[model samples]
Target: MNLTEQVLHVLDNALSLQGRTAGFTRDTPLLGALPELDSMAVLALLTGLENHFGITFSDDDLRGTVFATVGSLSALVEQGLARQDP
Candidate 1:
């Protein structure tokens, strides 16, 4: 699956969104827009992403801008993977 689909799936499962994430697009606001995206949800999302992508996230890496939009979050994942190359 593409990044968006993968992200949506992760969000759906992590938040128990009940498929509500189907309506999300690249423009979907996440950081401050969704009430469900509070501190706990942010931690859940971070853990889910680390597990799903098999990557690590330092506390310094968890910036609000990274989770601003679906596209931005996906791009951050892609960038993280890219950095893993030898």
Candidate 2:
């Protein structure tokens, strides 16, 4: 799967959203929008992403904007994955 799909998978698994993410477009707002996206859920999502993608996130990457949407989070992870490439 691509980064976005992987992120969606991670999100679904992390939040146990039970396919609720099927309706999520790239612009789907998270953070203050989704009640499922609390701070703890964010941490779980991060862990899920890291584990599934084999990447590590720095403290600087924990900004609220990173979790702003499905697209934003996937973009962040995409950038991080790009940085890991040589």
Candidate 3:
């Protein structure tokens, strides 16, 4: 899957959305908008993203702006992947 689709998949699984993410777009709000996205869920989402993308996130990388929207989260993933490039 592409990065966005992969992100949505990780998000859906992390939050237990049960496929509700099918309707989510890049603009979809996640941090404050989704009640399911609690603090624990954020940790789960980070783990899922790290495992899925084979990238790591430092504590400094954890920021509220990264979770603001689907697009922002995907961009973070993109950045992580970019950092892995040789």
Candidate 4:
């Protein structure tokens, strides 16, 4: 699957989102916009991404900008994969 689909899957499962994430688009608001996206959820998402993609996120890497939207999150994952490449 592509980054967006993979992220959507992770979000759906991690947050118990009940498949609601399928409606999300590139411009969809995150962070403060989604009530489900609380502090705990943010941490869970980071952990999920790290475990799923086999990458680690530093404190400086965990920023609101990376989780701004589905597109942004996918871009962050792509960047992480690039960094992991030999």
Ranking by TM-score: 3, 2, 4, 1
For each candidate, the alpha-carbon lDDT, in order, equals 0.84, 0.88, 0.95, 0.84
Task: Show model 2 residue runs off by greater than 4 Å.
Answer: none
Number of clashes in every candidate structure? 0, 0, 0, 0
Tens-place lDDT per residue, model 2, 1-86, is 66788799889999999999888888999888889888799889999888998889999877879988899999989877887999
Better of 1 and 2 by TM-score: 2
What is candidate 3's local distance difference test score?
0.95
| Model 4 misplacement above 4 A | none
Report the number of the highest-lDDT candidate.
Answer: 3
State the lDDT at 58 in candidate 1. 72
Instruction: Name the top TM-score candidate.
Output: 3
lDDT of 1 by residue, 5-86 (tens): 9888888787778998899998888888888888899889878987898888777777889889888888778877777878
Clashing residue pairs found in predicted model 2 = none
Between which residue pairs do clashes occur in model 3?
Answer: none
Expressed as tens digits, the lDDT of each residue in 1-86 for candidate 4 is: 77788888888877889999889877777777778888899889888988998988778777779878888888888888888899
Q: Which wins on TM-score, candidate 1 or candidate 3?
A: 3
- Give TM per candidate: 0.90, 0.94, 0.97, 0.90
Q: Please give, for residues 1-86, the per-residue lDDT of candidate 3 as tens digits.
A: 88899999999999999999999999999999999999999999999999999999988888899999999999999999999999
